[model samples]
Target: MKFDYQWVKDPECFEINREKAHSDHSYYASSQEMLMDESSFKHSLNGVWKFHYAKNYKETIRDFEQKDYDCKDWDNIKVPGHIQMQGYDKPMYVNQMYPWSGREGIKPGEIPEHFNPVGSYVKYFSVPEKMKDQKLYICFHGVETAFALWLNGEFVGYSEDSFTPSTFFLSPYLEEGENKLAVQVFKYSSGSWLEDQDFWRFSGIFRDVELYSIPSTHIKDLFVKTVMEEPFDEANIEIELKVKGKIEHCVIQSELLDPDGTEVLKHEFKITEKNPLLSIPVESPLLWSAEYPHLYTLILTVLHKGEVKEIIYQRVGFRKFEMKDGLMCTNGERIVFNGVNRHEFSAKSGRAITKEEILEDILIIKQNNMNAVRTSHYPNNSYFYKLCDEYGLYVIDETNLETHGTWTDFYDKDIILPDDKPEWEANLIDRANSMFQRDKNHPSVVIWSCGNESYGGKDIFMMSEFFRERDDTRLVHYEGIAWDRRYPNTSDMESQMYTPADEVEKFIQEHPEKPFILCEYAHAMGNSNGAMHKYTDLVKKYPQYQGGFIWDFADQAIYTLDRYNNEFYAYGGDFGERPSDYDFCGNGIVFADRQLTPKMQEVKYNYQSIDTTITDENITITNHYLFTNLDEFVTTIMILRNGVEIESEEMILNVMPHDSITIKNPFTPLDEQNEYCVQVVYTTMEDTLYSDSGHIVAQEEYIYPYQPVQTLSNKKIRIADDFANGVTRSTPKTVGITDKSVA
Candidate 1:
């Protein structure tokens, strides 16, 4: 097989070590640091960087770490961006087949070497006085495949697994003056075999790179888990602390506070030299749910001889999740997830999305009445999950593993089925375990998915079993397993994608063994899913059939400048590229620029718990609105006498977004009733984030005086045509027009 020689070079060994590379006065403390504003945090390392482009890793310079490496002759590029989109390399995309499959016939556990490029990045940075004394570690939020670090030409360390944070402590090598940080990012590493996600193949330091300091005595890691029982009248709390310091004995304390800042419970735990686990129980806890996401504060203090050494605060929720009677329940109530699949992305920045973009996404989701999100394809940034916890959304956190390309052939190679390999099982199970260990403590993550689109196999089955063994509180999800009956136990629910309405009903009827959920249905790609009502109608008809999440929420368009020198949104091929599946990534309810698309109008009404459709002759309302009392919304009845509103009044009606209410108003025909048309409108009394400030959403009109009632009696006239033989057969059919004809 032809090789991409650069693909085999490991880049994780040369990453920067902040402490030895520069001088800082910041106190040496815990590894974790606050990322909030004004916290003396530094993220400016990403702004300026001297860059060198290499055709492949084999041609890259090894002396990039040397301060006098004459990088002035090379081009510069931004650190937190993709090399492909920034004019360094070309972007290549292939589905179910590796990008180099045609050129290099490499199999599992191997990568092409001829074309694997390496990005050699160098940056000059200095430590501020306040942070000069502290132990510092350079952190990378994300890097594709692998990266290596070097400080002042001295090798720091190596790291792989791109989607998660990898921080290397740098304290031994110290310099009091100007410092040079160098890094070698390989396009592929040994870990690349596991990161075969179905996405455009590109590489670079696509996430934030920063230097952080830790105090001498600090909290290393915190685990907070809470349980509420007795109908939320009592609570049990468990807190585990990992500390790093010279302190002998310590004191830890915690307090449970309400949203109003009132303390519900407070306790202090005396830590002896022998014991460190602090477990406390609370009484009368306020449960956290999607409707009311109540949270509590857990504060831990490390002390030495009664003097406080350091203080750490964590915000957590007290709730319980279960799958009771084939229904996923949270806080003892069934949850109907209104979710969207989100690929951690940006049009301009690739996957290195900023904090502002993250905040904007959360706000958009909330405003659209979407309560849950599925991290499609892979795990996202750690900070993204923290935002989901704060903003109140359930998460089906997925692992960073997708082998879509390994299983399928583009030009007719042998089809690699899921159960074909023995080694594939172990590799997939490791991915699942790693993701669960990193994100297990998060409350927003209610379900653990076993990755996506790899299809089913014994190895995939083992991954599902691993989840149940490690964590039973949440159910496991793997949609591809639905295609293979051998792994019927793969997902807890009967999940399918894009199943038509009739098929769904048949499946529900045939299999009452499990609840039905469209893990992905209603192919909302381009102008599709026009008849969405058919699927929603099934949800109302079958109690065993739960709701499904939409295909996506936003188009993956990136911001760019057009030929006219005007800033515009661009899709796959706008960057002058080949081998691009242009606009296939633009499937979203909202446009890539964050503007609401017309499809949202249909989504909003269909997902609304309350349904009301008004007509001049009658009003039909179906209340699917959950939780809210119908009486909360004042139903305003407005009658337009003729094109112009002749009368309007607010009448109290027992109506809700999720409940059915029918009301008919007797109308008095005008003397010249033909001159006037009748119009009826129903709307909410108050402005909602979703609705346009109490604007009428459902209205109907009819021109009428009063048509005379015409009832046609059914008169049967049988007609039969037969060739006279030994047998004569006839079936009578009749057609008649009725008074209430739909035509």
Candidate 2:
């Protein structure tokens, strides 16, 4: 049973021969057809398990499943969690350096033998009577690095690479009564080179794990590719199916149901082989857009021997995306991206976020009038892309290939270029391919990013080329080329991270050949980013200056109770570790506990896609609805007294398409002495977005007092009072605010 594995260029060792029963390629069901025969099973293998920790690989037991070995002294640990967070190892926060910093100098594909920690996990369970004679398999949704598995002293399998699902057949190794399962997870493997993402490095089985039985006849894989022609008025649909077991006669039926549950198109085909391709024509299909987001259900039924055995359903949208006249267009309209960068992180769960958290993120983005998102640094979970497709949000699916630790040093010392590392080339391509294959079918994904923070090179160029060759449905993105100009064509657009406004303007002014985007800017660190209005103002002046993604959405935090027994989500350095940056990880628009930060007030104000201008002193407003119509929403007019509302009115105004209108009668402010600020709000007449009742989509506010300015001479400052905690300085022209310093 020994298999030879290459260090870096081994694609053969990655394939598995044993087939899964009743499992579709992209979808799997453990229901009546797959596991109902084993009804006595009560629990799943997803929660807590017995755990043993080792500091390094050398300290771990290589043969933990030896017949005489005993794991009675092992401690308890939760599955689907990180070993570092469970008190087994210290939480390290170095951006680019490996965890084995002072100890090792290992190159690519070489594991650190000295300080690579290993985790040994064990689970004890008994098979119910119904599952006695059924064929069973174990599936791991995600696992860090590499690991070997054993069941009751018999070796089952070994696997590496943490992003994809891997299943192993376990029927041959199961016992009749009590069963013992063992898993050994390593901190680093040769596969770790491909997983150099920017987030904190951790090791463990971080996703779901389940075991189920499968039926004899099943569909192994299904491929769906739909192309819309003539501006989504007509569609050409193609489906390819791969099946397992015997099929004397096969029949496939497909139906397209519209949003109102009406059958739009239906077709049936006959098949006699294992794999077959079926193509059908759909007339006058409903197109999907960020504005409308009309979706159709694709129901597929596979029949064998005149009996329905498999039914797979996929929700699809008809849309065409292309680049025209130097602009990216979707469904024949120029696509303007009002987007933000999102890291798949949770305050209480780290990267293991639940469905509710993900849905909440989508609602927030949509409510703020944002239509796009960039999966910054790496690819998110599969369910995230599915939700984006359903919710009508555009996606920039990024691959998991970031060597920031290696390239961060190059930035400081002007070290020519370090991206041509021969050992890391295959890893980069493999990572890009993995992300592309897994996310290609999603209608929401519009761009394929090679990676982030890694300086551009031939390795990344290959990745860009691979994306162009594999699929023409989306464009490629790589922001690192702004650092290395040698490969200017590596990315489809001129994207940079954290560039100043003047620099961005100059870059666009100089090379107007491609569009410009700020991938990461206005670093929202602490109570910072007071200058967001400056960059957004530039968007109005330049059309090529498309919008960009905010650096992040939320801070990564963990749930913990304080000394007063108050439960608060904690972040880096909260565990009392040495050499840590405290509170630096708390730089999210939302607080560590998922509570909205005050910074979101600025975000909601600036991220509004529409702008309203009121001419004359009476404030007759004009609405710039990017997606919705003014008549569809209720407008609220408010006059504020120095940031406080003193006079307000709710009015109904019907605005025509792209036209300006004057209000019939304007209400005058009651308070004239105070600084009277005028504000206008536009909300849905009926709830259309992901909110209940009504939600505000656009707002405009004008600060009052019009501060009359007076020229002041540049004079020296005089110290009025100086103290240990507070200091006061005054200029000759006017007294300034006091500055406080903490000891």
Candidate 3:
């Protein structure tokens, strides 16, 4: 039953019988289960699995999915891991070019024949008792490249688009006893050309694998959006519900819980339509922002004839992100993004970043005053967005598509992928749809990025339109439009990468029709964000100059043993791979091991929302936050002499946002000639999700109480222009008392 996998070479044939992409919201049977953040409905298949690695497609084991085949004796590999990281294949790193670019001479949308690795994986499990009579489904949260699935010797489905979740129904192939689930993952496919991200290329089942059963009438997909009217504080909560199975005659009990755990709104309604939109209006609702992450939990319970079927605890946020008066604005005021481009990576696991790492990343971002994050080249794990929502950080959710290597030359349009090519339209559209569907519900996701470095084309323009047509709450972003001006409307803003500060200012001055942002800037290579202040300074000069993202947040280096058995963080070309771009990927403000670099301090100071200045007579505070006031933080004043604090006291200054206030000096200046310093530090008065109380957010220092002029003598002897040329050396002939020793 060998069917030629010719689809691997065809860009159009990416998926067959794969389930449609859906919301990341999960469901539970009872409210208790929802509170516990656990679902009895989902059964995790993430563990050791029987595995075999093949160097190429032709070397793959035949009939490996057969019911009579024995795979228990095969080598074991972790389910949620990359084959390369598990000692099966070497991890490959190529920035813009494909891994086999110069080696294979393959065309775009074509895979290598002799070197693509294939992983054969088998896991055996029996259906849980709770899921006995339900519609069983197998979910692959994420798999690299392309893969085919089988159950009990029957072909189930095939899928691609490596970063998004792919689910397939297994009811037809289910048996009474133990079932054999086999998956064959190909290292390269037509999709490989689209997923040419700068990070290390690793292939396998690298995300969670789950088997789950849904309620008879389940909310298959859920979208919660906000509509703000006058007064701005008040908004309407809009929910789009897509239900599966029979939903008629069922009743929905929905309630909105505020951040303080109070029920603000509750309604009971009967299911009446196939896909329903429920809207609830409220006055003066709590808004969500990076400064204040106010999440209102919405609990929806489905009941049919007084029998509860499912309950969902979905976090909802009330905020508006739109273009207001030629500038990107959130809520009502023009906004600035203090952001970093984050690649989902680690020195240990590559893209398989851990939960702790995600939390660490978010906390570091928040504590360092970074309000936004650009998920550099692709969509990260779902948990990353969830934490971003909870901890309050703006996100630019990007699709898994990059054709950088395809554009061989600036004028070679024929070689570039999706360069108005009809055959490649569906693939880009699919990637966009996949990203939007999975991350649409997150409040942190303020923008949808088409992709990175794919260049501009009609296909990408159509993708922007697709995102706009599907979701109006967020804007579409594409940096490639800066490369090609054929489609000016592909991006909502004048987005660019690595654009110089002077050029950015010039562009905004000349073309203020749209807001401007450097999608990737201040290339933090080798821990150098040189002249970062030059870019951030433009935000004050022009409203159109919103902000920019640093090239990266964390360095992408892997730790491996050297010849001497000592461990070191290895970048490209470390594994003896050829044609590599060595150490070019190690460009992060933070080290590959997640330690803060010296560059992070510069970032914190440059991106800090509060501007503080201190002098001998007064201290001035300028609140740069669009939504927060200065009074929310605790400000401390310190008087120091010769680096030692002589006086310290706390003071309150309720300065409004976008406004500045100068407080008079209460302490008298010392008359004695000494090095006196005045320091003002702003810290959090209350504990935040990212930092504890008393954590300094911003500070300023000024030293004074010294003479302004330095005198070499009572009367300054001004030197003539030609004094040095005419004057004989004053003491050159004298060699002190002794010739060998100085007097």
TM-score of each: 0.81, 0.84, 0.94
Write the residue-wise lDDT of candidate 3 on 620-676 in tens digits: 789999878778888898887656677989977788889999888656546444566
Q: How does model 3 fare in lDDT? A: 0.87
Provide the lowest-lDDT 10-residue window in model 3. 734-743
Model 2 lDDT tens row, 488-593: 8789888888888888888888888887888887666788768887788777777678778776777766776789999987666677654344556656777655
Q: Between 2 and 3, whose TM-score is larger? A: 3
Of the two candidates 1 and 2, the one with more favorable TM-score, higher being better, is 2
User: Over 4 Å off in model 3, which ranges?
Assistant: 1-3, 409-411, 666-674, 705-743
- Which candidate number would show the highest TM-score if scored against the true structure? 3
Q: Better model by lDDT, 2 or 3?
A: 3
Please list the C-alpha lDDT of all candidates, in the order they appear.
0.66, 0.69, 0.87
Name the regions of candidate 1 deviating beyond 4 angstroms: 1-37, 40-44, 66-74, 193-198, 273-276, 410-434, 562-568, 574-576, 613-626, 631-634, 640-646, 651-743
Q: Please provide, for model 1 over 1-743, each residue's C-alpha lDDT reduced to its tens digit, 9 standing for 90 to 100.
A: 11223334322222223221111112222225322323453435777588887877669986777766656556788878888778887666444556666676666555567877789888777776767888777777678867777776677776666775666775554477877788777776656655666456678898888886665655565556676654777777776555566546666656666766787777887665332666677777766655556677665556666765555656667778887777777887667777778877776777778888887888777666677888876878777777787777888888766666655553222344335466456546655765676676677888888877766767777888898997756888888766667778888878788888899999899997787877777656787657777877877788667778788877877777777889987776666555466777777887877778888777755555555565555666565544455555555555453345566656656765455767775454554422345554445567643344455444444565543334444454333443344344343433332222222
The TM-score of predicted model 2 comes to: 0.84
